[model samples]
Target chain A: MGTIGDLGEFALIATLTRRLPQGPAVLLGPGDDAAVIGAPDGRVVATTDVLVEGRHFRRDWSGPYDIGRKAAAQNLADVVAMGARPTALLVGFAAPPATDVEWAERLYDGLAHECRAAGASVAGGDVVAAPEVTLAVTALGDLGGAPPLTRAGARPGDAVAVRGRLGFAAAGLALLAAGRDGPAELTEAHRRPRPPYAAGAEARAAGATALLDVSDGLVQDLGHIAAASGVRVDVESAAVPVPAVLGPDGLRHALTGGEDHAFAGTFPAGAVLPPSWTRIGTVTEGTGVRVDGREPPPGAWDHFPT
Target chain B: MGTIGDLGEFALIATLTRRLPQGPAVLLGPGDDAAVIGAPDGRVVATTDVLVEGRHFRRDWSGPYDIGRKAAAQNLADVVAMGARPTALLVGFAAPPATDVEWAERLYDGLAHECRAAGASVAGGDVVAAPEVTLAVTALGDLGGAPPLTRAGARPGDAVAVRGRLGFAAAGLALLAAGRDGPAELTEAHRRPRPPYAAGAEARAAGATALLDVSDGLVQDLGHIAAASGVRVDVESAAVPVPAVLGPDGLRHALTGGEDHAFAGTFPAGAVLPPSWTRIGTVTEGTGVRVDGREPPPGAWDHFPT
Candidate 1:
């Protein structure tokens, strides 16, 4: 197996980007100074996220492809949360000089596949040598002339709703941590988050006030909307969809588990939600997030401890 | 004065983004799921560059602010090389958990200031924990309805021209290596590159066929245009400007030094070049780069050695 050092920078880049099909919006693709992507709406939604080795994923637990997919999913979810259709993704990758070229190419494959799922493409990126593997993915989207659905737009009387998986990724993490990897689906969820990308526009069209991707657990992520909008969020435990596989502690995972990439939003109190949206709680005239009229579990995905 | 661990992620983020001014093209800024930037030309030019801590710069040599500025200059130069006007910048910063919060903020300050120099702004980004400090900067630009000026547009018999300093950064590296850092301008050039951002649109308007930023030396970078255009570039040493401060090895430094962020382009045989552009070479029907009819001295700044 050829290491990155053996292939050199340019050849490895060429190999990694070989036959990378450009998406419809990509006016120009890789191997250029910069990529030109069409933004027909006259506006582009941009978001960036960094995934580091060990802190974000374990190499033994997740394949490079899975890591790449997770990296793409997180940023795409952010763009979608802004009520935009993803256009292209720019990646900045860093790894040790000894990294295997095949591993890096597999990671690029994962990034490209995830972009395809979002109707986007891996437009362009930069690769450099560092101490550990790190992927910094920047996602760009077109807003389709719709005003962005920001977290600050949630009103006190809004009804909180969610679409897509909530606690599956966290459950998967639990299994992986305990060295029990039987549930393929659960473990897969941890490896690759499937964000409800389409639900963003649907919720926005349905007059959703505020929208966000549930990355750091449902309740913890909801706290962002609460803090940004100066409103209180009360997530009822019974209303949260905790799958049977999670057992008795499923509620805790659903409430505080992260990396699900589910779509969470607040609609008008009496508004009918789009398909697959489960009503979870209500926005009220207060501050902070609560579960069953009490404080939520203290778990959070902080980059650093307080 | 606190470490990142002491402040936590959210608080540090709030502090970093607080009061950050939005650029003219920003429809939505930081503190949201994604920043909405105006792509008035119906297209956005995007590029990403990663700067690793030890590989790109040593903390003892360059301050955090200088590192930030260097990162911004590199990506912005990429966008400009596409013949686009820079619009916005997104940064993905990864630092150790024990990193000083003040240092991180200063680095951000440097990023914001450099963006301002290019008439752009830091719209949004993400900060995460890592084993080392790394900055992943993504720059976006507007084409103003003009067709992109790619490297492949250069034809045989085109005139090769350059604008901005050629060997100052490399000279600075020499000074730093020899422990003589008195030449403030040269050393500063290495710490923070000042690319001729306006030269991009200027060259396009002047009917330049091909263009690129001299990130990896004049001969090396022009080799990109030569390879892409399937032509040979013969640089005239007499016409090339090598400043005296570069000393006896100025010509070699100008020819092979990297990271000057100078602008290089090819124009029609008799095209009137823009102001400040120095005619340095000619394109011919051949392969590879040459200096006065001889093969140029071989040197390169490769990320990974072959």
Candidate 2:
């Protein structure tokens, strides 16, 4: 098979979803007009993200498989960020006429790989011809009898914490942008993000007041927590953990760069932080996020950066 | 702001989702790590479609608003085809760095327009910078006491029927491709598809045996039904109602042209077809689709035409 135009939309989708594992949760799968997933809890947590070629990733920097992995990972992370267990994923892929079937298969392999890692599966998707490679992934999750942790739940006197690596993806991105091929760790981070999925569940179980995934810069994302929770968040710069492998600039990269996919949460005062997580800041009686008792620079990952 | 690169991802999404009406099903809307929607029925119907610039629509031929409407229409149509009531839509948009913010807003306006038409709402989505404009929309729906209508339910004695216009969109596409400024009706069909939302519910209520949307040509989609349902579908060209507004070649366009987004279904013999739906064919023993007792031409809307 060659380009999507040649394979056509239905055939392309059939080829892509052929090998995916089917589970009971999928009442209806790919060959259908729509996919039916078991929500069970009377509520489904859904989120969508789009990745465009060139802007999101370069074919030269990442292979088709990497792109698929990144697309699934990011969307699945969104479900996890809601303190839900990802159950299914629906993907939409648009690619040019000259694209190869092998490339698409590789991309699906990556998607399947990540979904398996997240204990979910690729349920269904649509394939269409486009001028560039674009991926839209929607993740559906089950809340597992727990109320969703929202940004508005944090209160004053809450202890702020983080789970998983911070700024490693950003460091990897910087390395890639600078054309510096250094360590395998950095390259892997950029190619496939390993978000702290378990931490989201852990935080929910721990009675976290507010929870969020650090996809944007830490300071900026904290500001969202502050704004939504109606409390000020103060991060102690020195206390914020940085990966040893990232060197001195790692902290800054983690704090400012986006796409780390780490989990950040607030717990009631005197609550014991999980051993897997590190204390980064605290919730206080105020509004907005502050770093070391001062306002950090505005606009960390604003889409319309001014 | 010029281009998605200029505004960045976060800011662009913030601007687009701001002030948009979030339906009751959206328990947690945008601004969080992920969105939480009220599934209510313990199952969620999900589908995704991606539209790329140039391949899906030429910017010169379609305004940003038209593109947005088309994108939302196609995905929501899938949910409806499965006998689900569309509840929420998640959009992912990718555009070049120099694109104007106003252009993005216009696209959202178009998306909102279609969502409103379906009695659905745009819940949340992502904005990313890319070299070309790309849209990925995922639609969520409620089945509401009805089992999903899949392609595998057709029986040998079932009657084939269709709701909504056929071939008009394809006729419009042909006119556009030929550079013929035809009637406004044809042009509107190509730019914005109007799928029969209520008809999907009605079909489910009326006990449709098999169902699908006419997106990739009637003959081809019917073939899918035939293959999936283990039955032969014979479509009578004369019975397949062609919209009169499509002019002389309307029947041909309707037969082979795609993107109508009309609901095509199979009902048991003597079953009452829903209002506005016309009988087009009948399900028979065997497999594959035939037109007027003969094998139809193979290349009609085949994405990978031989």
Candidate 3:
């Protein structure tokens, strides 16, 4: 109804946090000094990511609701990538004093809805004033007593498989950059990546050796697994799935696109994978990543050196 | 040695996270998708806070290192305020690409140092590009099997006590604003308020009826306790401590100053309190807070309406 400044700190906080759904794991929710989340495994998985205006997203292309969903999805994707079940989120929001209270509330609505989708809760957070809008989200998760699926566990003879959509966000981003809209799915993916939330535990149960989410494209992220596991990953381009809607750009997007939030992992070479997982590559005794037995060009998102 | 842009993302991340000391609770530290922190009590306490450039801090007044410590200290204090022992911190830092890589490294050093001071660790974090420096810090904690001390538990006739510092930071800010220095102790307190980390556990063990940290002045924070617990708090002016340097202004500063990170708690009447605590007030059968049975002026920090 009014600007954040008009509503004041206490009132603005009350409005944003009103009607939030706290999950079962949240022993103590918001409006406190801090929140208490149940770590059923006696261990907690935590990760944080910040999205800045203009740099990460443009307000013209994505609304506050989608921005909120994107922020929560990224951090939750990280927890799932670690083979943990999402439990709670703590958000640190900063915006100009002139920001409309309605925008902030809608953002919280998206945040709460996403947390519910992931089976987590919006527990606690802080609000501050800044020149530009910035959302810093921290997601906490439970491991259910299983060992974490670290990137250093893959062996040379492991089969590489991935679960969840690949390259759709990147393609969507390109469409947005070019001022093109419909194929709304791609652009929407850029805003809200549907991370395979259950895929993490499934991989763990299937005895995945090494695991990570594909945030910085398939090749770049898999390179991390290669470096950490001391092995080489060779992806067969033919085996990579590309949606027909993407057309000729599909191959390129599937291979080099970012913001997919897909899980890629290695399992025993002959082991059968969960149906959701698509076999795409193999881990071999070497270093670096290869596309169809050849080195792929350098590409992926970076924070600096533009 | 070079700017963050020159060093790029991976190298800069490596430099910032290198040689970081992780505590026993951290099963996995930086360089992973997420961190695994041991939740000794099977429940995790979490809180998040963000500091914006020029808003929360001034580059000329304090360097990156002190800013890092301040950010970590505030979030850690929130966890401790909930009667939990901090376990890990997840930092989301965004800075301009032109920022000095060494500056970022120094900032991380202070974060690590402060975490170690509080028996916690820098488990994991993220770095991104932004127009201005924004550091969002999230602290995770464990209860050690004790019940949390909430603000809603106080009852009339309970004795109130406070541990740690008060007013020094506010006084330091006044001096800084006047372009004065020396009284280095007070100025140092402004840069990094020493939170009584152990006092929270001490209060918990001693059966605190209600508890909270004074981040927004003594009266303002106590008002939260009063409102939530549905009781009045009458602070005895004579019992409040005043440093020698503060002179006549000491009493006013101690009552209205903010950022001391001190803890205030209520105990059953005549209950033995920890040695460090100073009995300052009493919970009363009424509404609102009063100083010597009179209302004090309105004063406290807020994010908006500036």
Candidate 4:
């Protein structure tokens, strides 16, 4: 296929939108100036995230497909963290005119695939020319009439739990930085996160009090919940799962590395959790995050680390 | 006075979001992973647009405030074109780390101001680092139980009407290009378009058959309605208003220049129109648009013009 410049904006949009499989939530899909989505519960949970070329993702390391999948996964995970079911996404893509049309198509395919996995659809999007590849995705979700599980809902006696592997993406990042080849799975995890999307709703159904997606490190992200709820959270490092691929520093990665996209929440003490969720710690009357007993090192990922 | 790099991401976010004025439509505002907006009508109209530095707006030409106002206005107009009341906006902004924090703050203030003008709120947003300043705004609106006024609704003999200025922004652009300083009003109009947001709902109330925001040139954009509705639209060139600053090229700009954000629609012949709407054209049994008696040149704005 020729470059996007040769195809022009309208033709490229036509080719990209032609076969997008929209779900029931999209009342009107991509052709119009705006999309109409059925928000059956009278409320829509919306969130947006932007990924820039060099800052968020390196094209040299991740393919267009991988980048797209990662972008969708991150935003979908955010909606899920609000205890909502993702219904649709609006993508704003900006790239140089000379960029390959095939690359753009593959990127969109990855977005469609990931949205399908979440039972959502690519409802609409805008495309524009920029100096670098950039993706700004806005995700919308329905609450299904359930009250959102906010970070402030964590109670002092709540049990902290988590779903999905921790630190696999971070380990993968470490491997990439060191120029070392990982066992294929760890490297793949780094490129595209497989967030347990269903776990958020499941946790809500099981009476989880507070929830958040673990985009930052586990302890670091849980700190947000602790601060919001005005309660203490203690993570039992031994209980935090470490994938074998992370090797000797697996525990460290599990504690402080980011981009795992895991689901973390708190539930009433002794509340039954679905098999996927494992109790990792407890909420108490305090002010911040602690590992077993003491405050953990502030090694979590900071976008603009001081 | 420091750069964004000095403030860091979280600190900057804290300063930016600490006092955002949120309207009642926002059920839950920022600080969470996602924002929840009340969609009382059981559905929502959603649209997104991305503006890149140098591509969409030049920093030297438009202030940060003007760019932000323009960005919010364009997206809000898209939602209005769907015959909905704008409720909230999600902004995803990416800028270089060296960018002045004050500029970012002013841009957000402009966004907040325009959203307030539409009776909407800044629900949530994301911030990231990119090589250039980029903004992706997603607007969400409620339809208030009204069916959307799509492009495919005009019928033969319907009278086409327009609300708001024609080619005003374009005239301003021309003046800016020529370096001939005109009225401050024209220069401001180029920097920030005052889209007739309320006119959309009024047109719907007036039984408009089709509606669209006049972003692209009048003929090019109206041609969309003609193609979708499979009808011919004939504009009375004499009836189209021209701002005096445009001089002789006023007619050309009225037909071919873009970025006006005017509301244009078609109503049944002889139907009573809202006071602000003016009959400018008539729909007939052919396809495409005509100015007076001939097809106008298709010299509309294209992001990647061939």
Q: Quote the true-contact fraction of every model.
A: 0.89, 0.81, 0.89, 0.76
Mark the regions of model 4 whose C-alpha exceeds 4 Å error after superposition: none
- Per residue, candidate 3 scores C-alpha lDDT tens digits across B1-306 of 879988888888888888478899999998879999999799999999999988777778888889888989988999899999999999999999899988898889889888998999999988888989999999999998988888999999999999988898888877888898748877888888889899888888778998888888898899999999999999998898787876567887788888879999999997899789999999999988999989977767666654
Q: Write the number of the candidate with greater lDDT, choosing between 1 and 3.
A: 1
Cα RMSD of all models vs. native, in order, equals 1.3, 2.0, 1.2, 1.3
Q: Residue B277 of candidate 2: its Cα lDDT?
A: 85
Off by over 4 Å in 1: none
Q: Positional deviation of A163 in candidate 4, in angstroms?
A: 0.4
User: How do the residues B183-298 of candidate 4 rate in per-residue lDDT, one tens digit apiece?
Assistant: 66677788999998898878987899999999888998899999889999999998887868767788988888778799889999878998889899899999999999798876
TM-score of each: 0.98, 0.95, 0.98, 0.98
Two-chain complex of model 4, DockQ on C-alpha atoms against the true structure: 0.76
Error of 1 at A106 (Å): 1.0
Give the Cα error of residue B23 in candidate 2, in Å.
Answer: 1.7
TM-score of chain A of each: 0.97, 0.96, 0.98, 0.98
Clashing residue pairs in candidate 1 are none
lDDT of 1 by residue, A1-306 (tens): 779978888988899898367889999998889999999999899999999999899999999999999999999999999999999999998988789988998899999999999999999998888888999999999988888999998998899999999788989899999999848878899999999788987898789999999887888789999999999999888999988987667888888888989989999988988768999999999999989999986887776553
Which candidate, 1 or 2, has the higher lDDT? Answer: 1
Compose the digit string of candidate 2's lDDT tens values, residues A22-69. Answer: 666788888887899999988889888887776677899899888888
Tell me the docking grade of candidate 3. high
- Note the Cα lDDT for every prediction shown: 0.90, 0.84, 0.88, 0.90
